[model samples]
Target: MNAITHNTVPTYQRISVKPLAVHIGAEISGVDLSRPLASEEIAEIRAALLQWKVIFFRDQHLSHAQHVAFGKQFGDLTLGHPVFGYEPGHPEVYSVGRDRFKSRFDGARLVRPWTGWHTDVTAAINPPAASILRGVVIPPYGGDTQWTNLVAAYHGLSPALRAFVDTLQGEHKFTPPEGNKARQEFVSKVAATPLISHHPLVRVHPETGEKALYVSPSFLKNIVGLHPRESEQLLALLFEHVVRPEYTVRFKWEEGSLAFWDNRSTAHLAPVDIYDTEFERQLYRITLVGDVPVGPDGKPSVSIEGEPVAAHSVE
Candidate 1:
């Protein structure tokens, strides 16, 4: 790992941010999430999130309600998912862990090697601006999640390739994986509420104006104007490039750990090592409302099948 340079000064007065990697992740300390945050603290946290793509907090044991409260400090929360239902009573919380149905359908719950790499919900016309996830029941080892900085990945591309990608758009929708065929309920829900949107391949950050390669392997189906073969080859190259080891940071979760990421500028890979193991893992996530993604040309994403994701109204 590259060491933090002396020129990389801390940005927040209220919290201490320790960068985990040269480009992407940071470990933040000095404030409690369970309690209300002061205005200065909230602003600094947002600044840290924008700078570091994803920020981690260790040993914050937050209740479901407290988790929701901390997310509200940043922005209005969205439903846990566009299709999958939320955790009971906590509409904003999406529980992530082992899927019982997948195990029941087969002796071992197997998944496609590429299925876990994705942004939160790209199928929505307006994907979440940010997501806050808290670790619940964690395993003894394994199950580490990894995130890549899309902005850095975009800049890493050759100047000619970046220029070409700037003019392209890609289609995103939720499609059940081949492994999910055995789970009828999973297939049925996806069929009933299909969300499809056409988004710029290179999205301009609404807040920072930086361009990011908006690639979500799990949700993005194809580049809109390219031939099937051409799209596949191009996407394959981009996918492999965006996840190059230099652009990523891996996090090993502890029970009270939490991660907050800017959904617009990052892509994450969920834990693939924990499946079929005897260990148990569970986590809760809530997303903040995001605006329609605008491309370098200033054109916004267009929804083909579903309504834009609406903000959740807390009671």
Candidate 2:
């Protein structure tokens, strides 16, 4: 992997980037996120995000406002969630895992294999282009999050399959599981504010112009205009290919660790290992507003149910 040289970003002279995997993740050092960033520093960090898909930082414990401020450096921040709403005072901060007031039954309580994998809020017409997550409380031995590089996964497909998927579109919706005893409130909220989006199976990156497989099993319902059986078979095949070990990176979180990822070109899986155990995990996340996905054919995604997620207001 080519290092971000002084020529690339002048401020990167002090910043060091180390790749954690060949395709996806990198750890960045020599920059403190707790404070404000200069224009050149922001540019360097953005460049690293475009190249690595996901960048990690260790030992920078940020406050809720600090995290939101950091995310606003790149672009306008989206509300914590389209359906679930935001943390009390911080409209841009989304609290994950178990916390003092809320238990596991409140958020992402279900633990099925398919339910763990998703791109953040893809059910919206315009999904977030990027997401920043900071680790607050972490468990000891379990709870590792994994991210897969969709650009690499798309290229890994056979040429014929790539051509085929380039012409297809899929429907995504946040539907609650049937007969699940755990999250009844989650089900009620989803039913009240239904969201569904129709997006291309392959989306072209707005900034880099690269094509990525836009498959999020958790939200993607089916391919548009195809027979149910055919759609199911094809989606299952793509899902299996996207998470191959070679194109993915697993991250272990600590108290002050943070992960900033390009949501347009990746899918991530949250761990289920800490669910029933005695351990507790908590993380805070903020996302940047993204445009509607455009396919290689230059068609933009359409909203089927619900309004587009609005930008977060500090007021």
Candidate 3:
């Protein structure tokens, strides 16, 4: 949560929306994160997330505990991370920084050849429904994050292409980059990983019933029913389509700024230039537990490696 004066006229379900992008993001200016939110406020925020995909807030400098408290309003919080041990005492807070990234894939030191655009924790059969990130320290110039509207990307495809993708399933897994110095350590920590799960190429949003293109250059390997070359080529085209700038929104983080996004409908990328900079970029995140993704035909995601995520107490 970030601090901002709340004096806007009521609009969509109570809170007004000042959209950051035509398709994906909005600046929600009504609620204060530092205080306990009313049930109406939570409902409004949740509705905005489904409609806008991601929403931003300003000046809500909350502690790790406060961040988790706000996140609980929507759903149960996932562990700080499944594999990486982030924020020891505050198990629900994933603290990220340059020297140590507290994200799920933090310690891998596996640099993504691509922009690392991804929906968080897709390796799980059921990834998180949403994630809330608060900026503790932000750089003056770069380190901005960007998100793309997956639902828009799915709708952008030609009918024939959409039909083709709707029938497809793709393999997803996490493998450390070949040259990581701590590759073995990464393996040791995630002994249950290198997890391979299958999910539909196009996923149906559980809340709004919107369909979104769900594959990514980050973890998605190949389409199930195609040859390696065909899968690669088709996936390449889809990747390009999903990341088109027109379907995206960029947010510049400032200390006390917060970003709460619906992971079910978008892919996010941390700035590449933010790595190894002398300037500090510290942020804390809390993830909401998610359901197994369902495809257009109504089949649910089936795991090849692990069980569905068990729900935990929101408190």
Candidate 4:
């Protein structure tokens, strides 16, 4: 693969957003999400995602089909969880509602915990490449999503820290039995379809060739070759480091808005702030398929805790 150079920045038209990145992310105006995008427009959006890693479009009146169509322009759509069905005719789209699920940290009884920082589907063998989230019904205040630039996060790490991480691997699972019983039971029913898998401590971006920290507080279980207590401490430290606010951007949602992010180079968290209200918050998400992960080294990456297989390494 060719090295990603600073000169490789792609072209994009900007919307009237307060902050503008050099090319990291942009808001596009003058386009309606409910309508079909022209070939050129879709091409530009795809290129922008490869270049910027995240894109936001506001005031989209998209139906399930329209949302799926937008996602398909970038790549093949991965079906939502086999067990959890999507809205009819939109198998790729998954619904998130506050009525059924609750955020784990905030004790918000209806919101889902995906608001925690994580890349989409990191526990899967082939994690999602990108995700498109459409805000259906947003609260008047207190629910926002924050995204961190993993490339920037990795670049900010001390060289010694990066070197140390390069030598390590982590176990990832939906939930572990060791956690709270209710949490474990919920995850086991909704998230525990498979055993744990291991991934490299560092991941190389598929398109950018930039290195990023890949572990998340939600799915990452333990480090290989370390005692349980030692692994927990180390993981806790790393998780805190990865979510530092310096490398992050927060986006407050509005009804009919959509946010698309590259899973390969970003980690995100949803905030659960609304509680004990009659308000209903809902969102729909579509995930695109991705290739196997690779590491910075030019060798195929192997998981540490389980059987190692020849796979595309992040290099």
Please, what are the lDDT tens digits per residue for candidate 2 over residues 131-157? 999999999878899999999999999
Once fitted onto the true fold, the runs of candidate 3 whose alpha carbons sit more than 4 angstroms away are 1-10, 101-114, 177-182, 312-315
Model 1 misplaced stretches (Cα beyond 4 Å): 1-10, 100-115, 178-182
In the range 105-223, model 4's lDDT, one tens digit per residue, is 22323222322678876766556778899998998987788887777777778999899887777776565223333443455454535535667778877676778787766677788
Once model 2 is optimally superposed onto the true structure by TM-score, how far is the C-alpha of residue 292 displaced, in angstroms? 0.3
Q: Write the per-residue lDDT of candidate 1 for residues 1-315, one digit (tens) a residue.
A: 011111232557899999999999999999999999997788788888888999999999999999999998788888888788799988989988665346324333335434557887899898999989999999999989999999999999999999999999999998654344436666677677778999999999877778999999878889999999999999888888888899999999999999999999999998767865989999999998888899998899999998888888766
lDDT, residue 243, candidate 3: 88
Location of the lowest summed lDDT over 10 successive residues in candidate 2: 1-10
Candidate 2: C-alpha lDDT: 0.85
Candidate lDDT (C-alpha), each: 0.86, 0.85, 0.79, 0.67
Ten-residue region with minimum lDDT total, candidate 3 = 1-10
Which number leads on lDDT?
Answer: 1
* TM-scores of all candidate predictions against the true structure: 0.92, 0.91, 0.89, 0.81
Clashes of 4: 6
- Judged by TM-score relative to the true structure, which candidate is superior, 3 or 4? 3
lDDT over C-alpha atoms for residue 211 of model 2: 99
| lDDT tens digits, residue span 1-315, model 3 | 111112222446656679998999999887788878886787778777877899999988898888988988788878877766559788888876765633224334545334478888888888888889999989998999999999999999999999989988998767543333444556676675445679999998876778999986677888888999999889879888888999999999999999999888899887868765778788888888888889999988778886554444446
Query: Where does candidate 4 have its weakest 10-residue lDDT segment?
Result: 305-314
CA lDDT, candidate 3, residue 127: 84
